[model samples]
Target: MLAPVTDHPDTAPLVDAVRQLRGAVAASSLPLPVEQVSAERTNRVELLNQLDDYVLPRLTSIDAPLLCVVGGSTGAGKSTLVNSLVGDVVSRSGVLRPTTRASVLIHNPDDTRWFADQRVLPGLARLTGAPTQQDDPGQLRLVASRNIPPGLALLDAPDIDSVVEANRDLARQLLAAADLWLFVTTATRYADAVPWGLLQQATERGTSVAVVLNRVPVDAMEEVRADLAGMLMQQGLGQSPVFAVLESRLSEQGLLPAAEVERMRSWLSSLAADSRARSIVIRRTLDGALDSLTGRASALAGAVTAQEMAAQALAQAAHEPYVRARGEIEEGISDGSLLRGEVLARWQEFVGTGEWFRQLDEGVSRVRDKIASVLRGRGRAAPVEDLGEALHTGVAALIASHGESAAMGAARNWRSLPGGSELLADDRSLAQVSPQFDERVQRLVREWQGDVLEMVRSEAGGRRTTARLLAFGINGIGVMLMLVVFSATGGMLAGAEIGVAGGSAIVAQRVLEAVFGDQAVRSLAAKARELLLRRVDEVLADERARYDQALGRVELDPGAAEQLDRAISQLKAVR
Candidate 1:
């Protein structure tokens, strides 16, 4: 980084900010609906490599040695050129197509420490001499050379257009990590699309680049050089100097004549000897890399946002149906629908239905005494138990049907979402309610009946009231509360076809009013309705938890967008 010079801006903070941006993007996931998968992957890899390889390393030591990566299309004589330029066989040159498997970096012994550690190009493992270990493409063979100048290093990378995908990727990564790209291309492959594509990238990145036209025949050198120069100018690279290495007889080392590479070698020597030139190259590439981060990081941030939103949409889809089902279950209870069949029949048989209203009008105290006396018979509890069991079964079935419907609705909605469909395909059981759901509903109903009985016992206020409660028994009054709970919309007295069940609710209301005053009856009904609804809510929550677990597995990246924005803001401040 820039040491705090007298008036110059500090660069350490800027480097740290970019590193933060790189870390955020590195941890983010690129889920579906990304603009382009391959392009996004390439951009992410480039940003990370730029941070690890060039910007951080170079900024840490601004005066470190220069690295020039020699890259070209397959069979372009890059290794041979590297050996010729250094005047030694430090790098192996051969006739095999796509010859360079692992990269080799040659540096002067005086500058070995600068390249020995991972300060520069940290992704690559540094080694000495010919490789004795397994051929790992991620490693670089560092050969300390006396022929090369003190302030420079030459890295012979793989072919840019290799048949192997890994080799091509490594070449691009190496080039991005270089302070200078000394591109070598044969006269015939100069206009190839792949090499030109990379050159265009170099132009865009503002990296220092030079070209070597190797194996050009002497007769057409003028024509080919002119055309290559014109192409370079057309591609916004006219400022890049071009050198020609003419076809000539090889020496005993199978290398070109010494005179053929003299011009390029002399230019490299001059570049190494001039500290200002090396500094300019490093600064140009570093600034370009820094400038590109904002746009790249912003795009990655957008991808993170898309992934988060998609996950949210999927989760909402899984929940909306269950929410609707809970509402419908409550509605059914409030509308007197569950009291219709067996519950109504049994209550009427137990209460002597058709004359129940006539009996209620004979004065509250007298009606309470008469009902209590009738309910005290030893035979009364069996009919009460039957009615309670009928209500329990009805409520349990109601809950089970709604739970199944909610499960189906949630499954149907989830099937239309992006990642949801895949999850459902692998786990089709989610579309149906659990087999134990009905048993849970039964248990809940039984618990609710017990709650109603406790409520009745608590509402009885005095000795006479206690005597009446024991005579009628808690079972009779508890069933009365449940029947009132189901008739929340209005009892059968409001002119419904289910008036038989409605009469039972009305008789229960009158009896409770006789035992606990008019206000107490209304309060008891309100309390019973509240307890029943609360119990049903608990059941619905249990059912909805299944879908909740599914959505929980999505694992959306939290705070990734904010991290990116903060890093970008810091970078902008430094700029």
Candidate 2:
């Protein structure tokens, strides 16, 4: 039995700190598909189970009955031991491999209030009834019996090495929730790997544990007990009490003989009746659990740091390729590369050749009249519209090609990354440019062409150059301006293409210079170039956003690790 709650120091601050730590752990997501990430995730879940099922509840209710969870390997007779301890069949025991399906909590009727609520192991659903063979392992069955003492509760947990994964997980959770573990093992199976693994964990966490060496041959009791005791000493559990039960036939009611469990039963009864002794057991387990938190929480914090690094690396991998794509787009627009094929031929037809050049050197007024007369004679609408279409096609194709390349580059980089292949597998569309990309690029070029025309209209408004603009036609001048903007950076073209493309740019520039002076034409080209690049950037950014969305699915809160560290430090201080 525990003393009054006031016998212990106030733990409100410690509880609050641990709660904060739990929140941080819960918020630190590890969704990336990496090798170390899976193990770290398991550690995170186990830590959370310990805090929720035991630490927080025990801190708040220091006077709750001692919960001695009887847990061990498969076929270890844990259920039979629990029944024999209480001197009744509170839990079923049989030859079936897993006799205990749901965990059975047997408490004295007077202490039912403590076990009936959600204070401890709050995640499990509670069912109150006699223990049954059909119990669901997902729930906790509460059985109140006067045969058990008030200050102690025996919870029969599932086998530690149950073939069902859920049962194995539930067994681990129940053990973590215990104030004391009554670990049971048969003499024949005492050195099994699975039960010893859990014992090692108990040693690390400092949980109070006792061993039950059951079903030893009567003549071999001394040998097995001594060997088991020596093994416990080697594993740092020397102080844990060990009880030996010899192999014997069961009574008609399937209960062990009264003499077989007398010593262990008396020990539990005395431990429960003595408040000081009970407090020692509780405090020892509680302090050990608390002491283990700093290292465990720190480990979890480190895992969060790893997750953040992985996420950043993935985002960067997706970002670099788009950055290069933007640079390439800028180069294509400014290096006179876009003024090839259809655009160049269309420009020549729209501006004519020898006579148009001679006319440009004439007076501005004479040049304007000749340009208007020749355009009207040639029926200039078709030539102007044809040139506009050619420019649109060229710019659209330039942006579309680079956009596709950027998508492929980002996808390829992601496949080479740790978790990237899985993400790409989930969304195959990310491997290529978006379905609407070409459509957007076409609209972008058309909108930019419209913008250049508007600039022509705006710059020529209320100026003497308005006549030259009208003579050349606003559409024709806009197309000429597009040509100049394509090659605005000067000298990227080389060899024969440079001469043709370079001469075409010069003709477009002189025509614009004739209308809007040299400085104004240069200003218009600069502004137009800036607008086109800005639009291209917007298009490519949308493409980059696809990768951003994928990364967002696995993103962790960047501050989760620091918050966990602070919580652990505060908990240590309060303790």
Candidate 3:
């Protein structure tokens, strides 16, 4: 026989470890919308209830009174059976569908200290008398009866198949908390799927159990008893004693005949009086509960892992599109594509197109003097501000188009992922770029244009008085620098547009070289290009942050699964 838990060397450590394990299990959450998530959540709650209601309390108070929870289908005569066992009317019995709304624990008056406190079934509030009108189903009514044996307590649980879902749930919870189950069923309900399902659970958990076949017809007693015995044997519950109570009328106090309950009552009395027998029952149930923890904990860990994987997949889906958008934007700036449309037209006007282009091949001095005479004779101002506005419009459109595309791509990818639709529904703004995107893009382009002008002025430091700089002016040179940056990779351009754009770039580069020298012009272009790309990167990152914020609401803890595994290992080692 197993030794009493109170005398075991590892009892204290074992309890501590189980307590830690309970904390770990409670912390594991399945917030993501993965498959089978509901079932796993229910399993998690049941495991926690078992640990809190039974395992920890039992381990700590190994010598506490044996708690036998009487449970079965609706109208199973559970309350009547408890009253008969105690030989008093401590528990109310009736014809109502669920006579026991709240659980009633009847203990020997001498053993009141055990049931009066929150040592076991701590989830429930304790009431000191018979259930009254004001009692809620969540409270546990404690009845101190002198007729009950000293070392035993009988808890009349709600019907397992009660029409009320809360009652059924409470019944299952109470059964999981039992050291022994005294399942009462009438001849009609003996074959019920509900009670038998619970009986199977009891067998699996190694809980000590006994069956009382209540209200058996006198003529069918022998046959019904034998059939039930065979069924119990087939279910691996053969060792559990079965008692048959012949159909009999109730007494004035609505109690079963004394002769009919004497046998089962004697059996309970004997088990309670014998310390060794009580210890065996407690050890059997407690060990089974501890052993079952590994598999349940492992299953919970698997669910946590699933949540983490799903979250990662969703994040990756959102991330890839933004990466593509950034790359495409970088390519757009380098390939001379932005030099078309209004920007090209503005550039032509600023440089005095047609005859002015034909004279560009002349030596730098002759070309500079010709430009000054042509501009001074025309008596018309250069369109420098107009060119700047055109550049602003082209660059902003490029960035905004790619930003919109990235948003659409991410939303489409998320639609195909598990649980992604729900998140999208919760925050519909993720499907589109942020409302401030256009405003931010416009601001970014304007700032970039300002920086380009500043770079031009700084590069012209000592050369501002040169004839070439005086001819086109600072604004004229700044816009030319902007055009050169757009066509820096002109070799990559294609078709007829390439010649137009490439020729435009060469003219701007020659003019800039006249003022700042060849090396200074190239350095200025590189610096301006670097600055523009960096600003674009920041704008795109802010747009991506919208999706990230949505994801943050549902992401599970990355370390939760590992914590649960470690807790399980610690508990197993102590066991």
CA-lDDT, candidates in order? 0.79, 0.86, 0.86
- Candidate 3 lDDT, 12-82, residue by residue in tens: 88888889889988888898779999989977888899999999888888889999999988887889889
> For candidate 3, what is the total of clashing residue pairs?
0
Ranking by TM-score: 2, 3, 1
> How far off is residue 464 in model 2, in Å?
2.4
The digit string of per-residue lDDT tens for model 2 on 1-575 reads 22322343777777798898889878877788765888788888989999999998998888999999999988888888888888888788899777788899999999999978899999888988676666778899988999899899999999999988889999999999999999999989999999998999999988999999999998889999999999999999999999999998888767788898999999999889998999899888988888888898898898888878878888899989989988988888889988878887877677665455555556645655665677878988888898899988888888898899989999999999889999999899999999999999999999999899999999878586566677787888888888889885446667867767876777788778888889988999999999999999999999999998988877678899999888888877766
TM-score for all models, in order of appearance: 0.84, 0.93, 0.91
In candidate 1, stretches whose alpha carbon ends up further than 4 angstroms from where it belongs are 1-9, 19-38, 91-99, 159-168, 186-196, 213-231, 244-257, 352-378, 422-439, 461-468, 490-498, 535-557
- Collision count of model 2: 0
Off by over 4 Å in 2: 1-8, 132-134, 353-376, 465-467, 488-492
Assess candidate 3 and give its TM-score to the true structure: 0.91
